[model samples]
Target chain A: MMDRRRGLGRYGLSLLRFWSVSLAAQMEYQLNLIIEVVASIATLAGGLFTLSLFYAHGQRLGGWSWEEALVVLGLSTFLDGFSSTLLRPNLGELVKQVQNGSLDFVLLKPIDSQFWVSLRNWSPWGMPEMALGFGLVLVGLVRSGARPGPGGVLAALLLWACGVAILYSLWFILAATSIWFVKVWNATEVLRSLVGVGRYPISAYPPALRLLFTAVVPIAFLTNVPAEALLGRTTPFWCAASAGLALVALICSRLLWRMALRHYTSASS
Target chain B: MNHQRSPAPEPTTRPLQRIPMRRSPLRIARTLLVSQYALMVEFRAEIVLWALSGVMPLLMYAVWSGAPAGAAAGVNPQQFARYFLAALVARQFTVVWVIYAFEEDNLLGRLSPLLLQPLPLAWRYWAAHLAEQATRLPLVAAMVLLFVAAVPAAAPPLDPMRLLLALLALHLGFCLNFLMQYAITMLCFWNERVSALERLQAIPQLFLSGLLAPLELFPEPLRAVALHTPFPAIIYLPAQLAAGGPIAIGPAFLNLFGWLALLLPLNLLLWRAGVRRYAALGA
Candidate 1:
């Protein structure tokens, strides 16, 4: 147990070091960072405005109160920021690497290829988006006046971790497909569009779609469960289901990555 | 002796004749159409992925349906679905990637050679737009038919004449959006971050163009303001027409053409200025 803990601690420190270097490099482009932050803020405001408009027209959406809906939006925005900043800059590179056969360098590294690829780059400019999302979550919590118990907070934390795992697995699956079909970048975009539905409450969709998002794609597990936990509406069963789904996704993506690596051919060939 | 030499020299060569067989704009357009069509076929998978990205409308449809019945003021679930379905099809035609394309071309110095060509740059952009839309038509049609067949209530009332008119409006909408985007993209010649401007513009386009919701659902003053702008001519008007909603076809077409006419001169002016600003660096 002590050895395992030390190993995990070393990995965490390395990731922290990678992020610091990446952040410093990104800070060199100060003007671009400022512009991106400003643009992201504007987009956030626009999204909030659209949400308010819906509330103005309808008192509730998908049985969700306005504050609850805001919570879901906040969670979605936070996850989106996390993915774009970390997973996107790195895993998104997998496509180009596969196309150019530069992925051989990644595979040759002593570190885990998936771990290295996922932590290779970071966009500090996206930090503002995460900040704004956290702000929204606070606003929603304050407005809703929902105070979660200790267990609820713990459950929310666990579910949030599961959301992250599921996202990483999904992204890995997308990147893995490029090994077979070199031109699958657009497929990733389609996946983004599909996952984007999580910005709204799952109940907002039709019955059939709700099932698909919940079970097939499991997008509802990403944001809804976290938000619901914060609202003290999460059931133990739902929490377990989310964790189970994340485990399944992780195993499936691991298998896919191994299979795909076998098909990879260096550009020299 | 000099006069005899000059006469012999004059007899040695025939005068050259110039042929006036320059390609008409029509012929150039045709050639561009065919070439772009072939290119689009090569990128058919990408085009399909692009079409599949139009899920926002479907999401809104779900939200509208889930909203309390008659929750969207006066718009019912069926009307909402019909409107969004129409918007989806219209969007496949009106979507423009000029900003990104221009940014890349300008940054990479590819626009220099294109400028040397006798044909105007707009023709190339137009051909690309036409090709993408043409390639996307079948997919859009399949999606629409599937939705309508599955959810019969989502089907919009259609008369042959009205459908024809709506198609015309949709085409004009595409032109209006393309012109506006082309004009916006000209900023890349002077600015490296035209994407910021595009995102800023998207705020208004989303709110005013009825992408988020129907314009009628907007509060009275906002609705009036949105109607006055050219944004509605892009997606909302065509959607309204497709849904067989109350719309003045004549006035709508006039609104669309007016926007197009205004944008044409602005586009030309910007293009000239942008070309002048293009340093022709690395050429």
Candidate 2:
């Protein structure tokens, strides 16, 4: 147990060092902060406008009220910001490293490869979007007048973490496939397009697409389920299922990374 | 006669000869198209992925068909399907990546060699885009056929005139989009990282371009404003025409022409100015 504690401490220190270096490198371009802020605000405004189009004539999308749907949109925006902050920068680098055969250097490091690959870089540009997303969620909750108790809030947070885990796993798995398909960069773009469907409630889609999003892509869990949890509308069964899915996805990503590493032939080869 | 004998001694100063190179516009365009098509065909896999990434319209169609807004807007699910399927095809052909491509070339110093060529540089990018669309043709057609077979309501009635007009609008929209993006791409000479600005531009395009939802569903004022922008001309006008929806063909075409007129000169002006600036920077 003591050894495990020391190992955790080591990893924690390494994460801090990695992020600080990345942050300093990124700070060289401070103008990106302003650009990111404006882009985030514009994106949110456009999203709100599009959402308002549905509710223009007192129309509800799949029986979801405007405020409830706002919660879903907020969650979607938060995940998109989360992706930009972590998944995009890190996984994008993973693709490049694989292409250039630099994964050899990463694997030879003392730390775990997955941990280093996943958390090597941090970009502050996504912070504005994340803050706006959380703000939107708060506004949605207040406007909807759904006061969740402490337990409810905890459950929502837990489920939201599960959503993030699932998202990270999905991204990592796709990035890992670069080991075999060297040009899988656009594969992530396809995923991003599909993830855009989460901007609306899953039920808003046709039944076939709803099934596809839920069963195939699990995008429904990423946004809708968390929003439902926050609204205190989700069942225990769904909560359990979400947790289970996150665990399975995380384990699958780890296993896939190991398998892919086995198949990795360096650029020299 | 003495010249022939002197050349035999040592052909020291050869007479210059005019090569008489015939570079008609038609020949240049054909050569560019053929070469670019050959290049694009080599990246068929990446192109397929790009085509798949354009499923936004189809997803929007699903949502609109199931949402109450279609009924409220007096558009049936069948009509929504047709419009979005048309949008998918229109977007496939009209997609522009000139900003990204140009930014890479400028940053990597690849533009210098291309600029030194006798042919105008813009024609190279233009021909590359056309060739990409040609390579994308079969995949997009297959997707359209599959969607139509699955949802027969998406298949519009056979109207050759409308088809021809839609085709014209599609190519025109492509030109307008390319010119607009290329104009912005000229900023690469001034800024190293201009693609981030492209993301900002995309937000307006996403909402206003009728990619997410049809313009008819937009509020009256919003729809009116959107019609004035070049965004709708890029997707909505052509898609609506192809879908046989209610749209003024003449006015839509005129809007496209007007934007084309405005952007064409703007792009040329930016190009000339940007090249001078680029050269001054010692690039």
TM-score winner: 2
Candidate 1 true-interface contact recovery: 0.58
DockQ of each: 0.54, 0.80
Per-residue C-alpha lDDT of model 1 across residues A1-269, encoded as one tens digit per residue: 23344557768876888889988997877887777677678767767766776687557887889998899889888887887798788888988898887888989965678778878888876788888888888899889999998998899989989998998899889888888878888887887878778888898788999999998888999899889998999999999999999999999998898888777777666
**Candidate 1 positional error at A132, Å:** 1.3
Best by DockQ: 2
Interface RMSD of each: 2.3, 0.9
Candidate 2 has a DockQ of: 0.80
Taken over the whole model, the C-alpha lDDT of each candidate is 0.82, 0.90
Quote each prediction's TM-score. 0.91, 0.95
Q: Write the per-residue lDDT of candidate 2 for residues A59-176, one digit (tens) a residue.
A: 8898899999999989989988999999999999999999888999999987799999999999888889988989888889989899888988998998999999999999999999
> How would you class the docking of model 1?
medium
In candidate 1, position A44 carries an lDDT of 79
Which stretch of 10 consecutive residues in model 1 chain A shows the poorest summed lDDT? A1-10
